[model samples]
Target: MRESTTLLRSPSNLASSQRLLFNSKLILPSPVPFKPKHMPCKVFCSQTSESSSTQTLKLISTLRAIPDWADGIKERGMKKKKSLYNHEKWLQHRSSLRHVRHLLSSLSSRVILSLIPPVIFFTSVAAVVAAYNSAISMNWLPEFFPLLRASSLPYQLTAPALALLLVFRTEASFARFEEGRKAWMKVVSGAEEFARQVMANVDGSSNVALKKALLQYIMAFPVALKCHVIYGSDIRNDLKDLLKQDDLSIILSSKHHPRCMIEFISQSIRLLLLEESKRTALESKISCFHEGIGICEQLMGIPIPLSYTRLTSRFLVLWHLTLPIILWDDCNWIVVPATFISAASLFCIEEVGVLIEEPFPMLALDELCNLVHDSIQEAIAMEHLIHDQLLTKRKNHSNEHLTNGRPTS
Candidate 1:
């Protein structure tokens, strides 16, 4: 029976059964490939992390470059702006032919009218000479009368000395003018410095009236000096609002208004500095005030020497008087314009010297005083504004602390 069953199962079936049993004994895997469900998620996470890290590095690099780029742009802009400002300022002082043209263009009708008197005088003198010459040439007047035709040698000899005299005169007057200007500048600087010191050093911000009064005095000092130097009697217009009636009256009634005002200013500063050691600075500034006044008074008292001035005037008169006669022989009608030109030049130079000698009205003291007044007014207003802002900030801070449940000392 066993032989018969073996014959029924072929050789192939026996071999497959043998292989299965062998594989089962060895633990063989399934035919389909093994893959995790989260394999794609892992790949995606790694890729995203790498990309994010690279992007973060790139962002950091860009942020680092940003400030450098901004700084470069700002530097370039500043340089360009500075260069542009310099170029504009350079344009003002350029030495071009326009300067001469400007002078010519500025000649006005008033200038021409002012010169007419000299022109008329020379023209009349020349006309007279021409008429006399014509009479002599036509034999209407006797030639034997010997028309006093003087040589130009005498006039030429006097010219050098006369020129020197005029130059010295003008120089002396210009020196006085320069001194006066410097003195006024000293006054301005001293007053400004004193005000600044008082504003900075003195703890008088609490007393608004006192601070305003000090600033008022600073402003009034220059105005008073201007008034005194220019011989202006009425300062009520300038000081009506700046000062109390009593102070204004004191300044007005005093013979030396500037000195009196300075004394009052000093007294006020002394009172303000009673507890401080900064009064020395005030004294130094007061000394500067005295120096300015002394300089102005010195200029006013000491004038150009009378002898030199008289000599120059005489020389100019004689020169003009003889210039026409000297040129009448050769120039005839032309001498008139020539003499007018010469006389106008000399007289204008002399007049300029005379005008600048005083250095008050001509230098425009009123305008200068107004400028100083405005500056002090503006400075005081600004300081007061700043003080008010500080007080407001302190109050705000204290209120903030109180609101935060803290006590402020």
Candidate 2:
């Protein structure tokens, strides 16, 4: 009876130990320990001890079979998860800007079209009516209607002069628009050329770190210009990919984005001067970048002055007021068309001039920032490609040296 009781107690103890070990296995990071309690046995006291030892050995062997027992799989998984999160953050950062749709929608074409017809119609009617009235008052008509007739020559001359002045003013405004566009193109071209020089011949090496630093200045310039013209302030985190943490922090330190970028470029150029033995080439590149910034600044800072604006506006208003009165007497049916045409011509001229005056502001109808951003991105991508190629070539050369039984320098 005593032996049976002991035997029953022994089996129950082993079962409890095995259950504990199995539960612990779920939380353990590595190889599970082998033990006699995890296995069933029908051996005597001395044999039971041996069987227990054997079961421990078997458990150890099974634990060794489990993959990831020795390797840091959990650490690697955490790292991978972290990398994915960073990638997502980077994508979001790059995509924060407003799109081209806003620019397209804000264009001045509709506004100009709407204002042109009224201007032309009114002006034409005024001219015709003024001529008829002058002819009657001056008695220059045929003798049969001498009482009502007058000289029409003064009216004829006055109408032509006013029409000529309006046309000339319109042409002048358009000329300014054309000039502004040319200047913007100049800025874009200069920026591209400067970036190319920096990437290609500046260091004669594929240094991604240095290239990114330089590209930041190039990328930031236009954005700064746009911000300056539109908001009169340079806000933070405008271009995440181009700007580094340090650059942003420094820029935000001051209130001006354009000036901040200019200072950064200036400092970068100074550093390049110190590092580069060739002084002249660095100076030329720096000069070009400055010139581009200056051109954009010129456009943004000096709009067609308010005085000119006021004069043009006043003249247009005065002309419109007199137009109806002059045309009311003659060509009453045609007055509407004449007034509309004259008004449209004047309004279109003014609207176009205003649109082009500040080219960097990016109106609904103006050039999109995507064009500038894409250009910078392409330059950066090309630089990266070149850097990768250089690295690969270096690796290949090292491998070749090893295969040829030569020491790599």
Best by lDDT: 1
Candidate 2: deviation at residue 89, Å? 35
lDDT of 2 by residue, 1-409 (tens): 9987787579787799788999999778975677655554434666878989999999987755433232333223222211222577677656745355434654333443344344544566566565665676677786565322234454556667565655655565566656555665666676676677676655635454665687678766766655555543335656565688877787777776666777787667666633454445655655554665566567667766677667667776766656655555564446556666667766666655654454443332113344566786787688779889999999999998888996558
What is the Å distance of residue 6 in model 1 from its true position? 99
Top of the candidates by TM-score: 1
lDDT of each: 0.73, 0.60
List residue ranges in candidate 1 displaced over 4 A.
1-119, 205-208, 388-409
In order of listing, the candidates' clash counts read 0, 40
